[model samples]
Target chain A: MQFLLAFVIGGIICAIGQLFIDLTRSSVTPAHVLVGYVTAGAILSALGLYQPLVNIAGAGATIPLSGFGHSLAQGAIKAVQTRGLLGAFAGGAEATAAGIVAAVVFGYAAAVLFNPRS
Target chain B: MTQSQGQGNLQQQKMQQELQQEYKQLVKNVKPRPPVLKNTILAFLVGGAICLIGQLILWFLKKEGLGDKEAAAATAAIMIFLGALLTGLGIYDVIGKYGGAGSMVPITGFANSIVAPAMEFKREGFVFGVGARLFTVAGPVLVYGFLVSTVVGLIYYLIR
Candidate 1:
């Protein structure tokens, strides 16, 4: 049952992305869609709308790019509570530091191992 | 004169019909019919699998007594790590080719985006090549993502 929920939710997100491809005749790249999702997620998270979905769907909700936006909002909120206005500037990066750092580190490792054009 | 006009109309209609058929043939030749069913099913399964792994990681972290927020953050980081590692090993592209959107929608996909570009640009020189191009795909995402989040934070701070 839980698996079904996750599958359905995650699949819907991907299907929406596929829809963009079809509708735009492939002109709009996937990166743009992902960026749009992230921005929407950030807005929804700030409005306190996305947490309920996350609560219900678990990774189904959070595994998408939107979830990254939600985390950024959450981090900023926490930071604002503790550090005041400066958190606005610093909070998102701090919150996502682990993921960001991991990407660079692991990305560097991969670059070393693989030929680019292959 | 009336008979000549009718003939001209008939000729015009025939030419229009032929043109329509020619247009259809051109479209058919230029655009390949996508394997819609296969792509959809692969996307569904692979996307679900990635989330399932994420849920398991979340479960284990929570079981270890981390707070919900902490566990969720850790899970995301770990998944990103896995995605980047797979991308580096040249495996994620294969999965991506087969899985289509299934592999690209997850947070791991974001990691793959970052790693793929870095690898592509590495030969140009590390600083200008790898570092500069590292964010080709991810830069737009992070830029708009962070900018929107900051604006939202400002609004929330002011309103609350």
Candidate 2:
């Protein structure tokens, strides 16, 4: 049931993007959509609305760019509670550091190994 | 003389219209049509598969005694690793070409976005090229992501 929820929710999010791609006149780029999702996630999470969806949907809620936003908000809020104002600056970065570091390190290694196609 | 000049201008306008029509036809013949339906299905299937893999990893982490939060983090890391590795091998681009948003909608796509530009700019040298372009796609995401979170945190702190 959890897996089903994850699949359905995750598939719907991607489908919305697909629909935009299929129907639109190519006005919106994928990066814009991704950033929009992340921003929405952050806002929803800050308003305390995203947690329930994450609770129910699991990876469906967490794997999308919005989930990245949720993580940033959650980290900031948690840090603010414990560390005060300083947490706002450090918290989001600390929380997302794993994903960011992985991207940079792996990206650099991949850059070394592969030649880009023109 | 005035009447002849008007006639000459009308003839030039007709020739211009014909040239425009010919150019439109030439472009129509050269433009390639993408396989939209196939791409949509591939995106749906591949995007779903990547999420399913993330879910499976989360489940495994939980079984190994990690709490939900810890498991979530671990799953994200593993997915990023896989995404980067696949991108390094040039496999993800094929998947990206076919899957479109399917491959991109997930965190794995984020990894690919970072790796792809870095690989492309590597020829420009490491510091100026790979290091600089590493965040081409993700830089905006991080900047805005952190900025918004900080504001939200401040607001939450003030209110509560």
Candidate 3:
């Protein structure tokens, strides 16, 4: 059941992105969509709305770019609660550090080891 | 004679407009339309499949006794690693071509964005090529995501 929900929700979110790309003739590139989704996720999360979706969808909600935003927002909120305003500066990056660091390390290794095909 | 010349100019303008419209129609007819419905279905299936994999990873970690948040973070890292590895193997692009936004919307896609550019720009050398170009696609995501989250955090702090 959890897997099913995750797949469905994740697919729907991706489909929305595909539809936006197709309908706009891709005037909005994939980069824009990715960045936009994260921003939207952060805003939605800040409003305390995205958490319920996260609760329902589990990895489905969290695996997408928006989940990253939720992590950032949630991290900040948690930090603010415990450490005061100073937490706001450090918390968002702290929450997402694992993902970001993994991407950088793995990404650099991949680039060094592999060549792009034309 | 002046009045006649003005009338001819208007006629010429009308003819140009008609020609331009005809060319537009011709181009519209020539261009093949994208398979929107088919693409959307593929995107959904592919995207969902990726998420399902993530969910499985999350579940396995939880079963191993990691807390929920910790499991989630580890899952994301593992997924990113897979994404980078697949991208290096040249498999992810094939998946991306077929999956489109389905692949792009996931965290794996984010990893692909970072690696693809870095690999492509490798000929220019590591410092300027791989290093600088690595974030061409993903830089905005990190910047804006962090910026907005901080603003939200500040707001929450002020409000609560």
Candidate 4:
């Protein structure tokens, strides 16, 4: 049941992205959808809306790029409470540091080791 | 003779415009429309499948006694690794072709965005090519995600 909910919720979010691509005739690329989702997710998280979704959907809510935004907002909000204004500048990146660093390290390795095909 | 020449030029311009318009109509009629419904279904299924995998990882981590936050972070790292590995293997592109946003919306897609361009630009050397182009697709995501989250944090601070 948890997995099913996650699948449905996550799938819906991605389907929305697909709709944006098709309706825009590819003018709105995948990168645009990703950026937009993150921004929207942060705004929604700030508004105290995304958490409930996360509670219900678990990884389904948190796995999408929007969930990444949610974590950033959640981190900043947590930081502000504990560390004051200084946390605002650092918390967002700190929370996501693991993912970003992993991507960079693994991405660099992949680039060095593999060749791209046409 | 000058007046006739001006009239002839006007006639020529009109004929050219008419030909262009006809060609546009023909091209429009021949171009096939995208399969919107099909793509949406594939995106939904593929995106959902990826998230299900994430959820399973999260569950496994929980069973191993990790807290929620730690597990989520580890899940993301693992997913990113999988994405990069698949991209290196040239399989992620196949998934992207079929899954579209479904494949691209997950963290794996983020990895693909970084790795695909990095691999493509390898001939230009690491610093100028791989390093520089690595974030071409994902750079905006990080820039805006942090910027907006900071603003949201500021607002929260002021409000409370």
Candidate 5:
């Protein structure tokens, strides 16, 4: 159920990009700005505004930037008292390393295998 | 050194300038980019799939020797390194080409942002140019991510 939630949540987020592509005249270059969009969404989620979206979407809303933000936020809270100010910088990376590594290895492999046409 | 010869040389110089101007004008006259639905969807799926794989890795690591906390951090570092590497090798761009933002929305994209600019400016000298601009785009994300996360932690504590 969790995996299913993650897949659907993640897939719907991806689908938004599809909608953007079909509806607008934006090029691939502008579309690359997705990192920014996700970050914004995640930050908003952290602030509590995006919670409803996450609840409704399940993993979909939370998985992308919001999930990421939640991870970092938790990390920071964990590390701040022990590490002080420096914890702010290191916490997120420390917390989310597993997910990060997985994405890179598999993403790179996919790049190699599918050789997705640019 | 005759008037006729001088006139011919002048004519050639004038023609050269006109051609340069024409080329510049042509470049400026490009049409606005049209939307590309297919590629964008491809990017999202590809990018999201990357994240999904990251999740699996973390799960595997937790199942192994490491705890979930340690495993997750290890995953981030490895992925970030790979993303930085691919961005340098010009491979990440190719994925971005096909998957669109879908390919970029993951942590790897953030990794690319930090590494790509640094690589580009490596020739411009390191400290001021390359090193400084290296993490420029990523700097904001990191800073903001941290700040937001702190707030989130507070909220989580309060609620749970």
Candidate 6:
């Protein structure tokens, strides 16, 4: 069931991205991606909805930018309460480390498998 | 004869205007952006495959009695290392070329962005070596990501 959820959620997110590609002529995607994630996280957090989504989707919810935001926000909040301001700043990165690290490694493999042409 | 010549001149001007309008429409409607349908399908499949592989890797590690965090971190390390290795091997460049944002939209592209520049600059110097340059492109992304997340978190924290 969880796996199904992951599959569905993950697929949906990608599909949405495709829609953006199809609809928008905007070449400026990175900014949009980053902003979209943070906004999603903020809204979900406000509703107290993201935590449940995380429970359901795992990386499907997380591997995207919004997931990164949730992790960071959750971490920062936790750290600030326990360790103070310094903790707030550093905690977010640690929380999102898994996804960030995963991205790099997978990306490197792809790079190795196929050489890019200029 | 004068009336006939005027009609011919007017007809030519109208056709020219029509041609210009069509050119403008083509530029407006169809762009050079990567094909959305294809990229979405590819990203979903490839990204899902990567995650599935990760879960399997993590399960095996956990079965060995490693804690969840340890197992998860080990898997993440493997993924990050693989991504970095490919960036070095120049294989990822090909994926980026073919996949466009399809490959990049996933974590892999971010990894490549962070690592590729560093590898290129490895020969520059040690202090300002490949390691330093590693974050060049990716740093801004991380910064943006980090700040956004922090602010969101704060908002969440303050409210709830």
DockQ, per model, reads: 0.53, 0.57, 0.83, 0.80, 0.21, 0.30
Candidate 5 lDDT by residue in tens digits, A1-118: 5445555566666656556555654354432444445456656655666666545544444445545666666565566656766665566667765665454444433333332222
Error of 3 at A70 (Å): 1.0
lDDT of candidate 4 over B1-160, digit per residue (tens) = 6999999999999999999999989987998877999999999999999999999999999999999899999999999999999999999999999999999999999999999999999999989899998898789999999999999889888988
Off by over 4 Å in 6: A1-5, A29-47, A84-86, A96-118, B1-23, B29-34, B97-102, B123-132
For candidate 4, give the DockQ.
Answer: 0.80
lDDT of 1 by residue, B33-129 (tens): 7777677777778887888888888889999999987898889888988998888778898988877777887899988888888888887898978
lDDT of 3: 0.93
| Candidate 2 CAPRI level | medium
CA lDDT of A81 in candidate 5? Answer: 53
TM-score of every prediction relative to native = 0.83, 0.83, 0.91, 0.90, 0.60, 0.69
TM-score of chain B of each: 0.79, 0.76, 0.84, 0.83, 0.68, 0.69
Q: Which of 4 and 5 is ahead in lDDT?
A: 4
**TM-score (0 to 1) for chain A, all models?**
0.88, 0.88, 0.95, 0.94, 0.58, 0.70
How displaced is residue B1 in candidate 2, in Å? Answer: 29
lDDT by residue for model 2 (A1-118), tens: 8888888777776766776677676676667767777888899999899999889889988988889999999999999999999988788888888877877887788888888664
- Over the stretch B1-160, how does candidate 2's per-residue lDDT look in tens digits? 6999999999999999999999989986997756777777777777777887888888889999998778888888888888888988889988888788888879989888888888888989999899988888788888889889999889878887
Top candidate by TM-score: 3
The candidate that wins on lDDT is 3
- lDDT string for model 6 (B86-108, tens) is 66676877765544444454444
Task: Kindly indicate the candidate among 2 and 4 with the higher DockQ.
Answer: 4
Docking class of 3: high
Worst 10 residues of 5 chain A by lDDT: A109-118
